[model samples]
Target: MTGLIKKYIVYTAVLIGLLVFLHAIGALRPAEQYLSRGLNPLLATIYSWGTNINVAFDEQTGKADLWQQINDLQAETNQLISKNAELKAVEEENAILREYLNFFNDHSYEHILSRVISRGDITNVIGRTESILIDKGSTDGLRIGLAVVDEQGIVVGKVAAVKEASSLVRLVNNQQCKLAAGILGSEATNGITEGELGLTIKMNFIFQEVEIKKDDIVITSGLEETIPRGLVIGKVSDVNKENNELWQSAHLIPLMNTNNLLIVSIIKP
Candidate 1:
């Protein structure tokens, strides 16, 4: 097989050499030129097809690049939206802090600001938040029975338990919470306002002859240690006469909803 391949290669070389010799004498030169000229159009067509393939490849690459740019822009837009929401929340909280600072200034009270961290809910008693946790605690000069108020000087609760870094505030409507309160216009009819059913403030043991009316404002009487007077508690929502012939009671709606209290001030002793 090797000998046969070598013989064929020798024959091919001899044929090419004979052809070159004929062309040199001007015998096949004209025919060779004619053949080359005839192939020029086909060569040009092949070159054009290669150029089209290159253009198509470039166009595909450009489309891929364009899609990548669009995805990058979408991700940036989402980041900006999240950043804007955070800024708006910060602005609103700053406004709340400023209002509280000014209120304490005018009222001439020493106080510390605290942020509410969490809330307490009784699953058995739906829709009631009995207490909340604040960021400030015993380390921040917080202790039990210290009155806590919202930005507008509305009493919301008192510090019930304290830890090194946090404290629990029993809301004004918690049954365990009681305040020495006075009717806005009836100082002589001062009574203790106790939270009833984790829902409303019920001032009990009022004499039946006190002549109390609905919508009367109740406030702290300054009778308890560390609690200031004139802090708004709520308005009388309903009045009830006692079954025990000697006493009467009324329901008071809290001035602020505990569910919305995110910041508060602890009145210093």
Candidate 2:
């Protein structure tokens, strides 16, 4: 035990002597500076790592926020599109109502305004014939034989059948709805205007000697009890006369296209 203690005291004594010699020569201060320089890079590396981590976290947060903003903008755009479509539909309805009102103000006859709801029969042969369903009905004083006119007071059709809320109009171009018409000219030849095939009107039974020509206006003769006088039916387009036959006929072109009609007035009187 004494020998081991003597060896430990000798080691401690040597370490003390070495530290004293280094201090006397100023070696401790230079060594401290060297140690500080070597440790500086390690400390700087730790700080750089911390800064990069913070920047990465911020970038992740910014990306998430940007995506959220894009989703919000898209939702707002869809809402605006829906609202614009609604506004456009309202504008169109208002324009149609305005046109009906203007027509009522200009005409002197007693009439009921009605909208065209359907065309042709269940067979869907609208192009071949002139039959349309109107919104007005028996409740609105519409009945069979009531004359229907367009916005410009031109004769379109007559109410052929009526229901409580709707009615069927047999247009002037229909084979069943014939009009007693007179040509507006010096001779004013009178004839029966009948609907021919393909939406054409033929004014038949006119005297061959009558001075009927193309572009002559044909109007209702008012000989029928239900129809009024002077309602423009159509204009003459072609005249067909046979030297052997005593009667002549003329093809009439209607002022309004029956298929394209939107609104009409039912002549109440």
Candidate 3:
């Protein structure tokens, strides 16, 4: 193979030398048409190959960048949506406060707004007594036995104990609790409502002769020194008189939902 390559090299050199000698003697002609045809094709192929590689790389980079941008935009959109929802909730709470304020002003009810600071969690078996704590206490004119009420003048609880700046309230739904309530639209007939659970209170001890109906508002009679007069206790939901001898039975729905209470008032007097 080496010998054959050497022979070919010698022949090619002699041919090139002969061509140069012919050209020098004015016997050789320039093949311009052949040069243009053969070299142009080779150069065009190389250029086209290089252009294809460049375009493919550029397109890949653009696609990667577009995907990254889309991910970033999605993250930003999610953050904005969460923030909007939080703001809307805050606005709704403020609207509720404004409504209560207007009603208090309009009725000229002696009142003060107290924010809820702590609450009883039923899951916490240690304090299943169903009580709530507020920020107001003896220092803020709250007493040990003061009646705690919601914005709508509905009794929520009575202050059980007071500290300098906080107080514990026994909720109206405490099973051991009892209050004197007057049946509205029934000519001042009063009954005793006792806490069945932390959910509802039952107004019992009505005389067998008294008439009771559903949807009747029950208010505190203020007969005792514990709760004030005219504070809302609940409204009757159902009434059943199974026999003429049995005392009329009724179900009372508390005016306040303890789960949603945020602000309340402690009746000082």
Name model 3 segments beyond 4 Å from true.
Answer: 1-109, 121-129, 186-189, 240-246
Give per-residue CA lDDT, model 1, range 182-243, as digits (tens): 77644343778988888888998777877777977777777897896666787889988866
The clash number for model 1 is 0
Q: Which candidate ranks first by lDDT, i.e. highest? A: 1
lDDT of each: 0.73, 0.71, 0.65
- Candidate 2: where are CA atoms >4 Å away? 1-107, 122-129, 185-189
Please tell me which model should have the higher lDDT, number 1 or number 2: 1
Per-model RMSD to reference: 34.5, 40.1, 36.3
**How well is each residue in 1-269 modelled by candidate 2, as lDDT tens digits?**
99999999999999999999997787785665455445545544554465456545655776967755754674464344323333443454456769777533222568899766666663534435478777766667878888898766678887888765677888887778888888653324389987876478889999988878997778776677787666777888999999999999999987655544666899876
TM-score of each: 0.58, 0.56, 0.53
**TM-score of candidate 1 against the unseen true structure:** 0.58
Top-TM-score structure, candidate number? 1
On TM-score, the stronger of 1 and 2 is 1
Name the regions of candidate 1 deviating beyond 4 angstroms.
1-106, 242-244
Which clashing pairs does model 2 show? Answer: none
Q: Candidate 3 has which clashing residue pairs, if any?
A: none
Query: Candidate 3 at residue 243, lDDT?
Result: 74
lDDT of 3 by residue, 123-237 (tens): 7334234677676655567777777777556778777887555677888887655677776433253787777756778888777777778876677666657565566677788
